[model samples]
Target chain A: MIAITIQQGRLFDPANQLDVITDLHINHGRIIAIGEAPADFTASKVIDAKDMLVIPGLIDLSTRLGEPGLEHFTTIARETKAAVAGGITSLCAMPDTDPVNDTFAVTELIQRRARQAETAYVLPVGALTKGLKGEALSEMVAMHREGCVAFSQANQPVVNTQTLFNAFDYAATHKLLVMMRPIDAYLGKDGVAHRGAISSALGLPDIPSAAETLALARLLLLAEETGVRLHLSQISTARAVEMIHDAQARGLPVTADVAIHNLHLTEFDVADFASFMHVQPPLRSQRDRDALRAGVKAGVISAICSDHTPLMHDDKLLPFPESVPGISGLESLLPLLLALVREHILTLEQAIKAVTHQPASLLGINRGSLQVGAPADIAIVDLETDWLFNRRQLMSAGDNTPFHKWPFTGKVHTTLFQGRVVHQPKLA
Target chain B: MFGYPGLSSPSLQLNEAGKLKHLLTLEGLKPHHIQDILDRADGFINTDTRQIHKQPLLKGKTIVNLFFEASTRTRTTFEIAEKSLGADVINLNVATSATKKGESLLDTIYNLEAMQADMFVVRHAKSGAAHFFAHHVAPHVHVLNAGDGRHAHPTQALLDAYTIRHFKGADFSQLRVAIVGDILHSRVARSQIQVLNLLETEEIRLVGPKTLLPHDASAMGAHCFTDIEAGLKDVDVVITLRMQNERMSSARLPSEQEYFETYGITEERLKLAMPDAIVMHPGPINRGVEIASTVADGPQSVILDQVTFGIAVRMSVMAGIMQT
Candidate 1:
């Protein structure tokens, strides 16, 4: 393997409380040294990373790569390419694919496809229920053996509390991490937007804050009973954040993440009936958004994930209520995180940590750090570059994003996965 | 009505030159634009006979009635309005159309556009369906939202406004209007509230059970009332919306009998309003549920007049958009 040296870059790894100009030495798919290279280190390649920020590659808690099924929306190859381009070195693949990731075979297929894709690391989240029908528990232990990082029902809620209790109990017995997006099936029925003034004015079906809080309340109680390692996904409301905070304070072994879009967008963005702004656990009120940001700042909400759900153009062309909900979020992730820093919602270090160590720790992964001997998954970013997010520049197969034409101040210059240059923008 | 401010987005419903391009919502419309519609509707009516006159305003234009939801009254009124304006009208029932054959909405629109349809009078089960059509339709084509899910019914609001102006006077500032029943789900009530608020009515009162009323009712520029009698007190105009039977199944109401007893308009309840106050409803009315038969058939009831004025108001909107 060729040795590479990244010279004089501002290495900012929040996990190690690092921020300094340093020379990083990489060889054999791992970071060999930092600051001053060892005397024995020889470099075959040198990268002039002057005037750039080098940080641990992002570890997104949730991203949907439409492969193993629904390839027409997006493929693992295409989405992984998009993910790496946005500085995501690893992303947890949601379990709600066509055949779903409830079986060992499905997990193996995803791992194999991801290996061939050779971009970001794909961590498969096994479905908590068979077929994700919320009726019966799946082979959680077996799927875990197939290298499923965690188990989740994705957007599907286990409506029967007894079934949910059993699923959690079984997961606890195996010490499996269970991820859940809280949603009371009855309360959130047919809802496409936040239940508030905007929805009332636009007349889109509404999902109340109680829908999330109610489900979260139920899950927290069950997690307490089963002693399960619970990771809440897509926390959207202020009440949900408070509940999670209270649960964490009580040491219920809980962690949570908010989708990147939910932190920036709100229900008012859907006021014009822009179908692209439609997302599940819908963009809530401004106050709710502020509370979510505060939750991230306070470490109550530990991570900010892309929650990238790519869809065909036609999927978002329907009326607001009829349109499928989600944002094509992979490419927009880093720039938006930078935006939070610029807007004073989070500090630069805090923002980077949310996507890196916080998510990495939640997934129990060894990635998302810049320590010597760590796999060299790094993002070299030109933090001062100004650009507009255009659909034409999207790498993912899906162009269904509400962020098109949004002006961003930062851009990824290069990304190294496993000590190899996986993504580098061609110079103009 | 003149210079009612900040009601709806003119950009979505208007052309580049700020002319009416689509009648999606009455929320952002200028009061004079609404007056223009009411005035044009007046022009369609023969003052002596009080009957609509057929015009050739849209003689060469093809208007398609695209009903995604079943509607007899709205579709019929839009068809009558199109015919009165001398436009060729085609009715497409979505349930029985290519939509059922799995053709997408865009494909359906493209097919209709391929047939040289110039305008679409869209009634859909989903809110913003008309906006979706307006967004995707050819630039030359216009869209008129007959009704969309709990969103807006522009022409209905206009006709109700016309009905009010016909009985009460052009000065809406003196009028206190009460909109009763399921305000949360009624597109008619939503549009009526917007139009009445834009006209600068003295007060817009929304009367319904808390469950049937939008939580943000005050934000829409209206006062909410749980008691129908309190809401009707001294109101110059009373608009009753049909309570959907589905509301019962949805746990929004206990029963029809309870709703009638609590909020239903009766002869005795009618005494709460001004003596000469006009009563209106976007029919078909549930006589025993939302209103007493006596009140619906009463002398002050302009329920049937609303239907009559509806044809003229719709004709006015169609002519206004096409001519502009």
Candidate 2:
């Protein structure tokens, strides 16, 4: 492979607080030199990155790449391609796959598939329990050795207190990062949308804020007692944000991420009972949305994720409640986050950190940085390009997104994975 | 804060001219909209009482009763309403329809539309099912929600409004109305509140156990009361809801007897209301669970009247949409 040099672009590397105009040299799939390069360095290929903002590749904390089971909805190759196009160079593939990734073999299968796809890095998260039934714990140690970045029950809540305690105990011993999507199973029972005036009027069964807060409080305490490294995913309520902040202030080894949709949308978005707006730990009130944004600003919420669960078209064609929960989020993730910066809710640096260094640091991964000798994972973004989001233009199989036809002001121009150009816009 | 205007149902339910295109929910309905439906229903009430007659207003139209969920009363009333208006009516038991044969709801809708149906009366167990139909149906066609899960039952609200206007007078601003029992699972209660609020009613109270009340029940322009007596105090009307049996299995209520003992509208509880107060129920009454036999059978009980008004209100709604 020829060495590549990216020239004269404004760079923003959140990991080291480096923001300046610079040139980067890459060789052997690593960033060989930045700024003043070695005298012997010569680039065989050059990428003119003028008029772009180069940053460390975005890292999503959670994503659903339906592979090894749900190939009809999505596959690792398709989803990772979409992810890279949206500026995500790496993502934690949720363990809630078919024949759940609770064992070393399943984790290894994901690794092999991601390698074969050559789209982007896939960090397989091992299931916290066998079959994710909340019964016996999975072989965490063995799965971790096989390259599972973290362990989670995915969207399913662990109903048994003892089961959760046991899993936390084991994870604590191993110093493993246990990611959880906190929800009180009973409180959210069969509920389709947020409990509010809108839900009441729409007559949809509602999942209340209490459901998230109560479950989050319990999990926070459990993490406190177990001394486990907890990374909470996709928290939706204001109270949940407050709880996570207080826990972190008390020095508990806990970090949390809010989904991008939660910050940009709310229960009002689901007012017409649009099936695309349906999501687990359902879209909440406006107050909660503002609080979540504040949490992100205060640095209490360390990252923002796609929570990118995709579904087939028919899956959303049924009645709202009967439809599956999730949004096809990967393709829209970057534009939506950039929208926050455009709207002045977040600064450019803050938005970059939320997707890059913050999430990478939470997972204890060293990839979301622009350090010399680091893997050349990078994204060049056009900060002021306006585009329309249409599902037909998406790479993933799932065309189910609430943001269809939404006008966005920022976009990813090109992405590189391990020094290889994986996704770039086609010439007009 | 989540009050994004585009998130509401009115935009989907009404046309650009603010006319009802589809009756999805009673929310966002103006005072005149409710008055127009009630006045049209009043004319029907007079005609039905005066003579055996049929109107040719909807004579050329074809109405389809697309019931995905069973509701003998709602379906029968809609059928009667369509037939009385002289429209051809078809009742489909969608439980055994092409939907069960692996057909999607939109596909089923398209097939019926191909048959030249002009209107659809949709009843589904999921909330927003009717709204879904309205969005996908042909622009010339209209949708009327018989009931959709815990969402609005607009015709039920209209009839309740008609029943109140017929007995207690058209002005609801000075009227105090109390809706008792299972407010959480009652689409009737949700729709009723929307209508009552639009009418600018003086007070609307929701009475139920905390477990059976929606979290934001008070936000629907009703005061929430745990005690039946407190909610019924000097109110001019009472609307009781059927205790949904399915909710009991989910443990929302302890037992039918237990629910009746705590929240049921007995004669003793009725005395707490005003002397001329009327009683209403959108029934197949759970005789013991939601109300006592004497109260349900009493002179003040307009429960049967609500059923009568249901047909007229549904007819008025269908006629209104066709006119649009």
Candidate 3:
């Protein structure tokens, strides 16, 4: 019975490449009409867009969330809240956890949990190999039939080259997407951040760029040779992006997402020696960040993900050499990225596409674009709202955000998932 | 003085009175005195252009290191440096002693003290344990603190200053050195900061989360900030600290994602510092957490050199104590 209308609102529909003055209509949890509200559509709720742009719910194909091993780090409930805040209606989660998502049971559990959160739709990534060990192929075929949209190893690198090639072949045969973190064990051994001058100064063990670049280089060959689809979970280096760009030109079915943390920050964040800034496939150089950012604009990196690793204080309080690496982005992902769009550094369409259509297409999801007869999954954001990040207001279960006091300019005013209000941010 | 453990109380400042007093923790330490000791150490280290690389400063003295904290690098540096100065050195595995007989703390100290111990190099579990014992015994017994529970490792600080002085040359009067990382529970930081002040270093900044830094550290003459860029701005030397996790028993930290956003030191942030600024950290670094591997392995990052110099630093510390 919550019927609302926006008298005037500018709308940007990327799918149709149209910018029009359209008033969207919603009733009983579905968009009954879009062009105009019916005469019978008496208003219980009404919103005037005021000529601000509106689009379909954003989607991210790759996000680290609902981590099974450490619920305290991030739970389905908190992640869903964060997802809604980020304007993301759908996401594909990584499969590397304590037990892993190699089996269909785990995938089903993830879907159930996301549903319980009642916020966003979660597509689980089934493990490519049993337990991500890469010794034997996982039942990718079976998982696809079981509603697992993609297959990937979240944190673990595909160690065996032949096994990885076989995985690509298997995924292609099944017409399933396989994602992997690009890190070569031999080159990245015991390394954390980008391995070069910074490492000598910080006294940390070194992780060579070859770890990221070589992995992509090898992945390119694997995809070309096997003619299979591959998705780099989080591309953190420039060389990886260039290699991927070349592979795409070569017509290899390869796709990648730059972790939001990777795109937004660089290796410099760790110069302060703050362990919380640490991340896997560690934050790369500024050149790498610039390239990754450019990749998003150039269309080489198709999506951006919040490689959110929710850790209570103890996890990061350890000596730099012993602390865990990862960041939480569910809460700040949209605002931080939107600020970029606001700055005109990136077009809103391109940015939205990175979070939505690009990622949605990667997952084969029907949720990113606003089309006639599509589900009314919507998110209303305050385009010009401004607020400093206090970390206290974020929905993350853990309070360890790196942007504790930084100011942000975009915020989710209201989030509707499957035509239901899941989160309504307090007006600033 | 560079021979560390070479001169018995070089009187680098040569303040009046008593034999060598071990500095384990600076909690109750006269903030002004830590500087004087370092000045004394520096004067000697500066004069010894020893191409001989060998000096008999602490000659004939017997040194024993009792390390509850496992630091082969620190321990080795001391042993090698002390031996070079012609002192007999011994290391004790005290961690197991308590486990076998459940010996109390004092009993062990008394036992060690009776072994005709000329100078004791102690790294213990208690913050001020070394300082406590330094005052407990007669003046003849000399002690040098290697490290103590999240307290102060004075010798470590001396070596850090020694390295900084080596790079910056004598006077640190106006030098800006930022210590980045877990300062709240870092014994190395506590001592390092004290030494930075001792060397008259100005603009000593502590960069990390409010949780990672000691509250009111600014009162201790440090400019505190959560942002690395702001902290790194125009700084001459950047000393990155290892994130201190041993202090946390359970959990309540922000995600690594959040931390990296605000604190990770990438090449971009490095531009904020002077081009020649060096990076320093206590060993066992979480590369990506506190620092990105790119910068940690980068040229400006003096981390490896810090590790390399750690040997010499420790060598000097052992030399000083044995000299007594």
Give me the TM-scores for chain A across all models, comma-separated.
0.99, 0.98, 0.94
> By lDDT, highest first, what's the ranking?
1, 2, 3
TM-score of predicted structure 3: 0.64
| TM-score, B chain alone, candidates in order | 0.95, 0.95, 0.80
Question: Is 1 or 2 the stronger prediction by lDDT?
Answer: 1
lDDT of each: 0.89, 0.87, 0.69
The CAPRI-style docking tier of model 2 reads medium
Off by over 4 Å in 1: B1-8, B100-103
lDDT of 3 by residue, B134-162 (tens): 64444566777777665567666766776
The share of true interface contacts that also appear in candidate 3 amounts to: 0.00
Error of 3 at B218 (Å): 31
For model 2, residues A239-282, the per-residue Cα lDDT tens digits are 88888888888888789998999999888888877889998878
Write out fnat for all predictions, comma-separated: 0.45, 0.65, 0.00
Flag regions of model 3 displaced more than 4 Å.
Answer: A1-7, A38-43, A51-53, A71-74, B1-38, B42-324
Best by TM-score: 1
DockQ of each: 0.49, 0.59, 0.04
Candidate with top DockQ is 2
Q: Over the stretch B44-72, how does candidate 1's per-residue lDDT look in tens digits?
A: 88645669899888898999999999999
lDDT of 2: 0.87
Name the weakest run of 10 consecutive residues (lDDT summed) in model 2 chain B: B45-54
